[model samples]
Target: MPDQVLELAGVAVLVCDPAGPPVTTTQDALDLIGAAFLGAEVVAVPASRLNEDFFSLGTGFAGEVMQKFVNYRLRLAVLGDISRHLAASSALRALVHESNRAGHVWFLPDLDALEARLTTPT
Candidate 1:
């Protein structure tokens, strides 16, 4: 019954609170995803507050964590609009693009869109 894990459209998702800085360390991200994956096939990371030190997952942090996701074949979903981040460094934009293209991650605007994607056949 924890908010962390829920079933929607026959897919399991692990939702993490995005109230503060994004998890910057790979260990933290891994721990979070590992815990969530216990009951879900996907992980949802909310974007409540952008991290000051690093964008999402900190600078150069996403790649490392992403590798783990690839290894585990886990899907990651970042819920929120990224209009403000569009102006960020080109590297960040590239990373976001790569993540999306990999089909293992997403940066959606809202829960509805996220749910839609989750339900849609891949």
Candidate 2:
């Protein structure tokens, strides 16, 4: 299925298909960012769609991809449970903790949580 736009809490979010291509490189992230430009204020990517390198902070892949979203003023919501990845890396856990506190990037457990965040005033 192609990416679909959702209007949640008065925000336009491009929800990427979990079965779609993996986001492995910075360029791939850029492609999503560009796509979101059409009518989305945020881009929701499934945790399964992210590359392994993204969870490994040493590779800086997560930072690179997230920075692109930040630079473009487009929020990124990573959906699905990533407890396994969080269990393996303390750095990633810390990153997620911090990112969740901000408005730029979010690592949500599911779409319901994303909607809650969207509905709540930041």
TM-score each candidate.
0.78, 0.98
Error of 1 at 26 (Å): 0.7
Highest lDDT against the true fold, candidate: 2
Task: Give each model's whole-structure lDDT.
Answer: 0.69, 0.94
The alpha-carbon deviation from the true structure for residue 63 of candidate 2, after best TM-score superposition, in angstroms, is: 0.5
Which structure among the candidates has the greatest TM-score? 2
Q: What TM-score does prediction 1 earn? A: 0.78
Candidate 1 regions off by >4 Å? 20-22, 49-58
Tell me the deviation in Å of residue 17 in model 1. 2.2
By TM-score, how accurate is candidate 2? 0.98
Encode model 1's per-residue lDDT on 2-104: one tens digit a residue: 3468776678887776654456577767787678757788877775533433364455665676677778888878778776775766767887777666578
The number of clashing residue pairs in model 1 is 0
Evaluated at residue 25, the lDDT of candidate 2 is 91
Which portions of model 2 show Cα errors greater than 4 Å?
none
